[model samples]
Target: MIRYRFGQDDVLRTRFAIAPLMELIGAFYVLRRPERYVVHRRWLKWAASRVGDLDLTLLDAAAPFGGPYWPVFVSPPPREPHATIEAELSRVRETPPERVLAEITHRYPDRLPAAARPFAGDPAGALGELVEQMRALWDAVLGPRWVTISALLESEIASRARSLAALGSRAAFADLHPSVSWEAGCLSVRPTSKSATDVNLAGRGLLLIPSAFTWPTVWPRIDPPWDPALVYPPTGIGDIWEPADTDHGALKSLIGCRRARILQELDRPAATLELAARMRVSAGGISDHLSVLRRAGLVTRRREGRRVVYARTLTGDALCRPST
Candidate 1:
């Protein structure tokens, strides 16, 4: 059990952010143990195909399977919400050489593993290589899907913010996850760590991060030189990987077949060109349909970097339900 004692300052300082590097790390872990994370099976299948030819030897060794902890410098907590992947990777590259050696030693106190020898021998050289591998993974496997993933994470934060306003912090924390609890000015998390740990939030507030790949568990950071953070699975994450149901004949009839097909394709937030390619329709036609759907309150649109993605709203989701 990990307990975090919150002072008056701590409560005021608590904030939320979306960490791209952390999400990438979580996705890599899912790849390592796909059987354990059945919820991400669909995503695993897609990602596996994309990275089949790429060499990930270093990343695999850095984040080995079944370990209670990985190196902290590999993925330090994000300082702000909406941090770009480039910015996060830059931070990892700038980690002090001493910190790298210290973390490597701590992770392997008895005998250094053969794969981790490079870090112990030459921290600077090894770190540069590691960062290159991580960057390649991002470009090949995660960069394309980042927009959709970011939208899902943003939606979770918006929903939680509403809850915080209406029900207060205690209620928000309680609903965060089954393994978390709060009482008497303390927040407790039952993490995968076997040891018991306690932390006082001193003055720096807690950073709450919502993650799609961190499903089925919550992670906490309580080390020095960094603000405390908690990463937990977000609501409606099960649907993040599920493909759109293509057999919505009834829906197709109510809204013209083309519009209905467009709505169905938005199972996980997609852009105009993507929808056009999947449905084999012109991009202009798809945009016209999306505009009508958006105005009708069935779908909503948002810009993610250079692309504008669309997703079904609550009413839109309800309309997709198959009639009895």
Candidate 2:
């Protein structure tokens, strides 16, 4: 059990972010243990053939026996909503040499992998190589589908934020993962490992990160040099690997093909531009369809900053739900 004690300031400062490189690293775990992430088995098989040449020596050693410190260097917590892979890699490149050596030693107290031993002497040079390999792996495995992946992640964040607002922090944390709980002034995480741990926010706050690949469990990073953070699987990850299913013939007949397809896609709320890009239709066309759906009481639009996002209503949900 890991407990994070939150001070008054810490509670106010708690923020959420999306980490792309973290998803890439979690995908590696899915590749190694498909049974643990069966929902992503299809993606694992597909990514395996494509990332054959990418070197994952560092990542492999980092998680030896399921530890957290090593992967933190590769996928450090993001400070903002729009963090890019390039920016995260730059931070990894600048990590102090001593920190790298310390984490490697901690992860492999007995014997370290040959690929990682060279880093003890020259951490900077070794990290540069690791970054290049990670970039290549990202391009091969995740870059093409990042648009869809990021949208899913963003939607999860928005949902959690709503939960935080409507249901309060404790309820929101409980909903994040089955292993998470809130008690007293501390947030606790019960991970699969036997090691029991405790953390104090100390007014630094916690960063809640939503991940597409880190399913079936929540991961915590509590060590120094990185902010305290939790990485939990998002709500709609089951649909990430599966192709969009919008071929409900009956519904299609009722609403017409295009609008029915649009309604079907609203299983999750999305912005006009995002729907447009996914459907390969112009934004204007999607807007017209959304307007019609809104009028018919099948969909509703809510203003989120500059974008007006659309989501299926309860009435629309009944229409889209598979009939018995």
Candidate 3:
């Protein structure tokens, strides 16, 4: 990587600096609000210890969906957000993604030089292709207003870019050779930490997915073995509460495969190796599905050192009409 005098590298450098700054600020923010973290930590500790998705599901069921974080209903996390570890996902259902991207580019020129940089070469083409794909995704789920989705969309992309730049490919996200994305409303994030050198890439399964498009948006991917229908219609304050039965049309379209089926199997909860063994597949296979499910809001991932555990969502339990 060649460094230009205040060129793309500088832009990446600034982003790297800012993400940690926000993270640090957020950490301090939580520390200052120790009570919030404490209350959440206590509950999360319980949830984490509980083995199956049923127990965790009960917690989500017990708690009001939007009590602590409202943005999730507006823009759910890449994974389920219980009382602990909340992330902001703004709703832009009323704005156009193209327009939003324009506004963002207009606002932060240095941070986003992609818009200003002249289109040329493969990188330029790849970036353009990625943007176009995001635009399509925004349109598919959000329709016209998805144009505003570009801001949040680009935020994810830029954040990843910065993380990779700062952390280095190995120290950064694991799925390096191939990138992740959401195609035709199907999430496409991949987690890979296959190390080639001294890089201690945890490869805790890279997830480029987020938490906004849970069921109603992604049920099409669930299969019998993976997600045995067990849920109740979600009747919350901000979401499409007690909505109609599952949209069979959409689900039918979501082509479930080995990975999708395994996710359905773990609709409860399982460790990395357990899920892999039960599904008769590779750990990476389960990790991939978990990453996608977590991103789609169907599953959740929590960390314990180098290993991050996985489980299904309670709201989804309601959707599946789980008996117990």
Candidate 4:
């Protein structure tokens, strides 16, 4: 049971952000325990072969299966709302040797495991090698699907924003998760790890991160020198890997099969790359369909960072929604 006491500043400072590395870490967890993540069965099927090719020896050691203490340097809290993998990896690469040693010591108070010896002996060199492995993992596995995953995470953040706007903090976070509760001036989170401790935000405020792979559990970061953070499964997990709607038969008849799929996927805003990947089509092909949808007022495009994402307009939504 970890309790976080939030002051006025803490409440004001609390903000939401997406962490790419954190999602990568969550993927590791999924790879380690596929049975626990039934929601990702589809993804697991697709990623199994891809994941098997990589030598995750060190990465596995860093986030060993069934452990309450993984080294913190592997996946640090994201400082930006829309963090990129490149930026996050750089942070891991820059972690001080002492910091790495401290975290390893904390995780293994008895004797350092053989796998962790490299980190203790040469944190910098080990970290560099670890970062390279992480890059390979990203490029081969997570990078391709990051677009859809990111769009899903962004949708969750938008929903949270609306809830915060409409219901204020208290009510908005009332049902963050069964393990979480907001009462009085403290936010209590019951993580699987039994580390009973209290944290005062002072002013750094908690970082609320929504992750696709952190489903069925919430991970809390209470260690010092890093801002308090809560990484939990976002809403809409069951449908994450499931086809938007295989029963879009009527919609398909109305608008060709290809266009129907593109529209259906637009339930959450997605960039051309994501649309192309999901539909197994080319970027140019998706762009053509999106242009048609945009002109028809069925979808709208807006720039988010370096990418432009498309979301369904009301007409598109109504069209996709089933009629009683």
Which one is best on lDDT? 4
For each candidate, how many residue pairs have backbone atoms clashing (under 3 Å)? 0, 0, 27, 0
Residues forming the 10-long window of minimal summed lDDT in candidate 2: 62-71
Question: In model 4, how large is the Cα lDDT of residue 76?
Answer: 83
Compare the candidates by TM-score and give the number of the best one: 4
Better model by TM-score, 3 or 4?
Answer: 4
Ranking by TM-score: 4, 1, 2, 3
After superposition on all CA atoms, how large is the RMSD of candidate 4?
5.5
Global lDDT of each candidate: 0.80, 0.77, 0.33, 0.82
How many Å off is the CA of 13 in candidate 2? 1.7
Candidate 2 segments exceeding 4 Å error: 62-65, 68-71, 192-194, 245-324
Better of 1 and 2 by TM-score: 1
Candidate 4, residues 48-164: lDDT per residue as tens digits? Answer: 888777877778767766667777888886778987788899998999989888887888889988888898889888888889989988887687667567767777888887887
Residues 170-279 of candidate 2 have per-residue lDDT tens digits of: 87777778888888878988864637877788889888888888888888877655688888888877866654333489788888999998987886679999999999
Candidate 1, residue 236: how far the Cα is off, in Å: 0.7
Off by over 4 Å in 1: 245-324
lDDT of 3 by residue, 1-324 (tens): 100112223223322111111121222233234354442243223333332322122112111132222111112222321211112212223333444344334434445334323212233333334334323332222322111122233334565566666775443334321332322212232332222212111222222322222211211111211111111111121232222354433443462555445545654456889887887778886677677766776655666446666654543333332221
